[model samples]
Target: MNDEEQYSVWPHGTPVPAGWRSTGFSGDETTCLAHIDEVWTDLRPRGLREWLATRS
Candidate 1:
């Protein structure tokens, strides 16, 4: 996920693009999605700061 909490899934062993870091967990599709749901509590596409600004 980015600073904005937006994420994309690339094929295993593919090179990650710039400005992204691995969450360090890898598995089949079901496992990966469960991990995301556990960790990614905020589903907003905007960064926390940006989202808060909009709410205000």
Candidate 2:
């Protein structure tokens, strides 16, 4: 994930993008996606979530 808290699947053994880091979970595409679905319940980005928190 990046500063935005978004999740994506990167090919194993490939270098991750500059702003993104591994969640330390590596697996096949389906498994990765399922893991993301389970953990990333909040779809909002970090900035948006912080802003909403301030409003609340």
Candidate 1 scores a C-alpha RMSD against the true structure in Å of 2.5
Candidate 2 structure quality by residue, lDDT tens digits, 1-56: 89899999999999999999999999999999999999999999999999999998
Clashes of each: 0, 0
The TM-score values for the models, in the order shown, are 0.67, 0.95
Name the 10 consecutive residues with the lowest summed lDDT in model 2: 1-10
Evaluate all candidate structures by whole-model CA lDDT and list the values in order: 0.76, 0.95
Clashes of 1: 0
Residue 42, candidate 1: Cα error in Å is 0.8
Off by more than 4 A, model 1: 46-56
Cα lDDT tens digits, model 1, 1-56, are 66577666667998888877777788988888888888877677676668689898
